[model samples]
Each structure stands twice: as C-alpha cells, then as structure tokens.
Target chain A: MNFVGRQAFRGPGLTFCRLLVARYSSKTGSKEYIDGLVKGKPVVVFMKGTPDQPRCGFSNAVVQILRFHGVENFDSVNVLEDEDVRQGIKEYTEWPTIPQIFMNGEFLGGCDIMMDMHKNGELIEELKKAGIRSALLEKAENKD
Target chain B: MGVPKEELEKKLRSELDPAHLEVDDQSDGCGAKYQVLIVSQKFDGVKPTIKRHRMVHGAIEEEMKSIHAIQLKTMTPEEWEKLKPS
Candidate 1:
C-alpha cells in the first residue's frame, strides 16, 4: 500500500477495514454491509481499494476517470479492505466482479461499462438523466 | 437443492420453444442471481419489458419462485442475429 494511502484509513484502528475484510471472507452474516454504504452515498463505489489509494489497476481506472471529470465528492468502499463487502457486493449486483459503481441508488456497472460510457459521453448523459447535478460535468464543461 | 441451470433451461425451452436460449448460472457459487439472454420467435413483436421477462417467468414456473433477479436480454431471433456480437 502507498504510505499516504495507508494514512488515509488510519481512523478507528482501521477496524472498519478489518471488519470489511471479515465480512467478505465469511459466507452468511451482515450481508447488508454493502447495502448501507450504497444508501449512505449518492455515488458509492465498491472497488478494490480506496479512491486516493487504489490497490488495483481497475479501481485506479475509475478513480482516474472520475478525477478527469472533476468528480471529487464520490465515496469509495474499498473491497479489499473488507471481504464480506467484496463477496456480498458481487452477490448483490449479481455481477461477480469488483470496481462496481452505484449512482443515485442504481447499479451503474463496472470499469468497462463506465469507461465506455465516459468515452462515448454517455456517462455524462446518464448522470444528467439520473439528476446527479454532477459538479464534475459542470467543471469539465467550464474548463473546456 | 436450488433451481439449477438445467432446470432453468428446460423450463424456459419447453415453455417458449425459444429459437435460442442463454441461461447463465450467475449464482456466483451461491445460487441466487442469474443473467439470461433469450431469443424466441414467440417474441417477434413484443414489448421489451414483457417480451424478455414474462417469457422467462412463463417457462421457469417454480424456479422464478427463488431466483431473486433475472437480467434479461430478450429479443427475436432476427434481433439477436443483428446483435450477433460481430
């Protein structure tokens, strides 16, 4: 892990991370761990690691994309930091993978889908359609 | 014990006599969520919602009782041919 990245999750003895790991590691308990996160954030990402310190390349891709669009307020739930979140998210979305993004209480798919939408400008379109009021898109347009 | 893929396939095929069926075992080793892409002549001019889902519901009968979700990609064979994934 990056030194700065480790510092990003220093609170609560990093017990939150450990709990997440344990949750995904086991099979049948607190399955709603992921649910609460999604409900907590209008834009929640269940990814390989945290946003500022993505542990995997896929999570990095999403972080980069969002940063490119000036999206800084999104919350990322690190899947690697928690096992229950890792497995339960897959079960919840039935997508069997990581780097999943949820927007306004809806599954927005993974990197491939997000990148595709981003590249084709569909991501902005859909985000607008979903009424996200993304300062990211506004900022991107302003800079352009 | 759960509604297996074979059961899903059989239930759908017998009910719809679909031109083609793709019943994915998306249980992710736990047997719950499934992603199905089905093409049937019976759905030649059907609405996207009813065409894709009700067809599966009609076929699965009992399995739909448990499968929490079904990501449907329903189309007529002609539509499927057009979307042949290049």
Candidate 2:
C-alpha cells in the first residue's frame, strides 16, 4: 500500500505497474538469461509464436523458411507468450521487430534478411556452416 | 492512427540521403505497413545485413511505434546497381 503509493509518487504509475509485472514474471527477461538461452543453440528464433503455430506472417515465414531447409529441431521462443521477452529481445539485438533469428547464437536479422538469404542461396550455405544440412541440398543431390 | 507515407519518405531522405529510395504503403492508405528500399552511401562500409537494418530502423524509430511492420531492403549504391536488371 505505502510502497505502491511511494512508487507512484516517484514516477509515472505506469512504470511502477510495469516494473511490478516484470518483477513477478520471473527473471527470464534479463539480458543474462536470454544470453544463456542463445549461447549454445545453433539456430534460435525469437518470434511472435511457437514454431508449430506462429501467430504473425513474418514469424510464420521464418518457420516455413527454416522448414524449407529441413531445420525442424531448431529452438524457438514465442515472444507473444511473455511481454518482457517480447520487449527484451528487441533491445537485446537492437532490432525493432519480431521474428528475429540467431544462428550459432549470433543475431541474424529479421524475416526480410532471411528471405533475402533464402533467395540468394546464402541460407543454405549458412545452415551448412552451422552443421545443419539443408534438405534443399539433398534434393539437389538427388536431382544430379 | 498511422503515419503518412510522405512523412516516412521525408524522414528517410533527410537521414540517409539515399541515391535510390522507394516507400510503399502496403496497408493501402492506412499507412500501418510499409516496404522500403533504400540505396545509400551510409551503408557503404556496413557489412552485416542486420547492421544495415539497424541503421534504417534507427532513422525511423519514432514512426515505427505507430506502424505495424516494415519490410526493408537496404543496400549501398553499388550493391543496388548490381541488383538492377542491367
């Protein structure tokens, strides 16, 4: 009661409320937590929804593009589930969008970059570098 | 409410001084969605694709709050020339 009132008087009540929300939502939104989550993953997508059921078209496109390369096992974090994560990821990568990709724990840009890489054959080359054989490669070999 | 296309164009023009620039309002006249193609010397030494995107995002950071999505194609003038059907 007094604590809430004091915090409200100190700043905008909205910031206090948001801080409370973040405090109660576990520490998953922390930069260190996200850093640990991506450190060892070969491919990770911080997107709008789960890999199996992406909510946004851009996120869906990311999932589908990875699927096109036969990358089904990559990790995915649905930003829609947690507001903190949704905001944290944007700040972490300094990219202002959903559907952010990280390859070998490195920020790989957003869906547009993925689309460009897919079209330019860079996605396959990148997957190879990450040690994940793209299904397209197998299909091309079969055609030979 | 959403931002006007001309406002975004003006912002990009002043910030990037792009040699070639295209801004398409993908959300009809509503202005919530946009696709931008920018070819500027500002991107000449920026190698990473994400870094290029960050520069554009930085310029229009304010507009982004109201806009839902932006499909950006950012490149140096030389890179854009190679992409042209010549």
Among these predictions, the greatest DockQ belongs to 2
Listed per model, the TM-scores of chain A against the true chain A are: 0.71, 0.81
Tens digits of per-residue lDDT, candidate 2, B1-86, equal 57899999999999999999999999998999899999999999897687888889999999988888899999898998898868
Worst ten-residue run, lDDT, model 1 chain A?
A22-31
TM-score per candidate: 0.50, 0.84
What is candidate 2's DockQ?
0.67
Cα deviation of B8 in candidate 1 (Å)?
23
* Candidate 1 per-residue lDDT over residues A1-144, each given as its tens digit: 464346447635444664455445554225455555666345778887688889867679988887776577677777775566676787787564567888876788776567766876877766675555555667767898
Clashes of 2: 0
Give me the runs in candidate 2 sitting further than 4 Å from their true place: A1-25
lDDT of 1 by residue, B33-67 (tens): 66777788888777534334555665675675566
Q: In model 2, what lDDT does residue B9 have? A: 98
| Stretches > 4 Å off in candidate 1 | A1-31, A129-131, A134-144, B1-86
lDDT, residue A54, model 1: 90
RMSD of 1: 8.0
lDDT of 2 by residue, A1-144 (tens): 685567578766554765465447586677876786587678989988788788999999999999999998887777887887888888898888888999888888899999989998999988887889999999999999
